[model samples]
Target: HDVTADDVRLAHREGYVSVEHLKRYTTLGMATDQGKMGNIIGIALMAEALGREIPEVGTTTFRPPYTPVSIGALRGRSVGSHFRPLRRTPLHDWNLVQGGTMTEAGLWQRPWYFAQNGESLAEAYVRETATTRRSVGLCDVTSLGKIAVQGPDATVFLNRVYSNAFAKLPIGKARYGIMLRDDGIVMDDGTTWRLSETDYFMTTTTAHAAPVMAWLEELLQTRWPDLKVHVTSVSEQWAGIAVAGPRSREVLEAVVSDPTIVSNEAFPFMGVIETHLTGEIPCRIARISFSGELAYEIYVASDYGPAAMDLVWGIARPMDGCLYGLEALGAMRIEKGHVTAAELDGRVTIEDAGLGRMASTKKSYIGSTLRQRPELMREDRPRLVGVFPEDRGETFNAGSILCAADNVAGLGEGWITGVTHSPELGHWIGLGFIAGGHGAWYGKTVIAADPVRKGNVAVEIVSPHMIDPDGERLHG
Candidate 1:
């Protein structure tokens, strides 16, 4: 290929003046030699075109292995399954002993479902979901990213990072919060529990755990150095298990040293308590429910995790409770229309995820101004909604394109992000995003067109809160 300064000048004339943009616009640094010969010439040309010194137009960032390296050099030992490390929770072996089928969640091998008496995946999860709703269920939640934010200015730090108000979050309580990227897209959503006046515990999704921690550190170190705050990852320090269901309180009452503290009046929903489990094992319990059931998440030191699981399982098992896993967890969240990684994908805005109300109007936070960009606030943008197969027994997969019943071609209105058999509704259900949201399509039939899979099914658009719209079970 011929190299020329004319190409750089053309890119600059086209408004791709930044070195990064110039390189991309004109392929300045993408030669076989990796720009060693022509990148400088291109920069000088770009700078000349703008009538600026060469230093004024900064150089493009260089990526390493300056010279090309062989594939064998990069793959010294790690390859195939060993390429990435695997993480196991303290209850990993216990789940296997109880017939849990494992699946990957990021680097962690979490139980997908617990099969009993040779039940299929669907049968097992259905049983697990039903049993949990009817009684108690325990799930390993240790993979969630745990960060301990403590300092004199921790409250101020949290209030600015989160889109919602956190300064007024009372001590001994937990509040759901969402953070946004500088570009105004939702970065992550999780719950933060205030342990004391200056101490707070935050949880992030398993896949985002590391990134969220790094993001926080970057903000404190680079953006808000004046703030006196320290954030540390405590994910490995604590092993967490969620005890959920209508009978969740009953199960906790049996395990906690003081039954009174686990009561509805004493503990209350979203309340946090530092208490001891059976045998006086110290633990932190938070009243939170991802399954939309009255539930509590108990956290114990990593070393005490196995013993804590044993104690909780012993009591829950005898009470007809079962151990649920990721599959059931997904089904439950879908039933309640809760958003997860599937919906919080970087492309979505807070409002697109049906969480606009969580964005505080009283105070400005990260992404506050940019989120108001006209393009993001457009009413026609795809927003979260519930999807259901028009035929009771029909099933559709996630990633299926949602189109009007009359038009099943092209990208259509929107797409399904997640799908599952709703044991509660006794049919298949899904959570997806569609233009104009549920209000625009409620009671209307649409085509779930999965062209890649060669299937197209008619589906009804409805509110994301397909079950427990009023959250009766969650507060029961």
Candidate 2:
């Protein structure tokens, strides 16, 4: 039966004032189909009853699924075979053959780990991490966001967007840059490689690919219309593989046409090279490391990705190389005290994240003025630091509140954001924030109270760099 006009009047008289409240109270549009037919009628009735025009009364905001449709229609031809709309890397099929434990990251289906028979998920990830630290390991990093910036004003455009200086960066060099929000919080961190005098390749975190592209477009089209800069997203056009560890050069030398291209003397760390593999497969390589170890990220065209992946695997197998996944990737970053979206979450300022020095003073960039607000530079702000369980065997939960050991009754000093067990350090380490930074609590013991998980642990505050404080391993 249709909803009668009286239902609307009764709902109003009962004090269900707001349109949303009235709708829910009367169950006016709560049908399985969300009342595609009855919504307008109900709105009209309410407006009439309220002695106001329809616009004055207003209607519920229309959302998705405009009209009722079957799931079958949405699925269309992409039934079981392609239901997930997954973006697979070139070695996706080969990873399956190697017993990869697949996981979804954004729209891409990435391997979480390559588990061996009789190995649990944790064991597999730990083993992969240990192997990479000891020898060589490769990870498919194709999901990273890529953008091609070409034009005479490309340098100027980048200089305006990033906090660090990039206009003077020479060709064949890569610089790590961090972009901040208009309100001074970090937006994203990535490496921008200077391909030539007028062109550069920018890489962003995978989750920010689309938004960052939109940001650049807005800046160019709305703000700097006359700037000779053209930006295009090329994440799909390029496939990336990060070769990390001490023996990375050895494995890369075998697959690349010129072994000298990757030599330390010719291609120093943070160097970029445009070249081809032995089979004439075109590629671009950047010497960068996320794992605190010597590493190189190799990028090839989409069509040649599969063959390149296979070739690298073939060469790496004989050279004691292993395939690792996201679990190991995260742990390695934690050990190195690096921050991703997890630590740079939109609310914190650059100084709070321990990246204040990266923001330049001599030159202007986005968020430069806003970042200097006196309130943001307070010494008591929650600053990034490493915490370790006192017992070494105990572990605290992520999101656990931190408090002074003697003042457990207080609100909180800060909270743990990330946790990981370091295979190299042989203990559980964490990245967290505290109100009074290094100067205040440099070696003091604090309590990590995890109310949600019903647990607590005594932790020692230390510098975020839990391993290789001098970065000797990374430079190796």
Candidate 3:
């Protein structure tokens, strides 16, 4: 009677040798998707209650390719633009016209700024840096990963996948969230835009969008298959650009009519809205600036993304839009204490990323078990933090190991994941993960652990938030 008596009788007559055999014959839990939506224990309980053997009820052996496609095969033949769906700017044709060289700055292809009489790559970057600080600068950010997740369970799906809670995020608002591995290690961080009560868009570092989306789906389908949710990547459908600097607003306002649609009051910092910029042009814009300055990121459909970018450049050239590049963005991010993918890679945990609070330990979730281990909670772990050379003039190439060696100067220091000569700070700044770098390790010096130039590099412990000490820039 405990066994679904009606179902059991059906199985008996359906040629299933037994209840266990019935499961095998039905191929229950026998698919690559892993019967993520099926009944496993319930059937098992049915057999036990009926005094039947498990083998008589055989298990569903979910086949291989058990999870998702192999990263190598999924990546397949495509590299660069071809591999990931990228927005070729509407003015991409103009790049050929201007004889400009282009490269990836996230998922989008951005002009590395026009080459002058004879400008080399280094010269171009340096010039671009100065232009933005002194004038204005523009960047194509179309490649930042974007995904639209919809369905009634969308909110629940997002909350489970991210370390932070998302169920309470109000519609028409956005929140910055971090995703973590089952072990409480940070996997990725991104902005979640609640387009409506049931529809949402997520943007992640260009490198992790595809993987993160897949991770979310697998968890939902397998872990909570009953939840109603669908996630789709739309990174290619829209072209996005960042126009930054003190004159950024001026340049944007100059190109558009009825500036009120994209106004500072309506599209304020971290605000999300579906609206147009440039009265005649009609481009969707978000007042999100990653340059650590007042900036606007304009989004337009793929067909117009390029043209919008060109028009922006025309407006920016007069205002001195900085021909900014990846190097400069990397530097500004490090200076702002923003630990991106480089610092938050698989080796680091949420706690190490200074976002230990991001994870929810009070509730049941994946990776909640191993996260409680003493080793994981210890302070001696290779904690993520900020570091710089004590001697300003000397340079320490990144990835230099930090050592307190006795006879090492100008030698290898701690390994650097990212380093930059900051115009804002007047000294080279860097960010990286340092083993045993927190707690009593504060203020203590270390030597670069690299074998090639052992003990030459010198560094001191510092908090990761070197700039925007109190997040004044983000708030303002």
Residue ranges of candidate 2 with Cα displaced over 4 Å: 1-85, 409-411
Q: Please provide TM-scores, in order, for all candidate models, with all chains considered together.
A: 0.85, 0.84, 0.74
Candidate number that wins on lDDT, 1 or 2: 1
lDDT of 2 by residue, 105-189 (tens): 8778888998888888788888888888889898999999999999999999999999989979999999999998777878999
Provide the clash count, candidate 2. 0
Candidates sorted by lDDT, descending order? Answer: 1, 2, 3
* Most accurate candidate by lDDT: 1
lDDT digits (tens) for residues 1-476 of candidate 3: 13344554466566565534755555555545455445365366556655687666555555656675766876666885477777565546666466567776556575655566798765666666666655677766667888988999898878777777787987767788888787766788878888788999888997797788788778877888898888888887877778777677778777776556556676667676665556466665656656666777777777776677777888888775655656666666777778777787687777777788777755555566666678888776776677777787656666676555564444323356777776666777788766565554576766655556533656777877787577555444
Ranking by TM-score: 1, 2, 3
Task: After superposing candidate 1 on the true structure, give the runs of residues whose Cα lies further than 4 Å from its correct spot.
Answer: 1-74
Full-model lDDT for every candidate: 0.92, 0.86, 0.69
Determine the backbone clash count of candidate 3.
38
Candidate 1 weakest ten by summed lDDT: 1-10
What TM-score does candidate 3 reach? 0.74
Q: Considering TM-score, which of the candidate structures 1 and 2 is the better prediction for this target?
A: 1
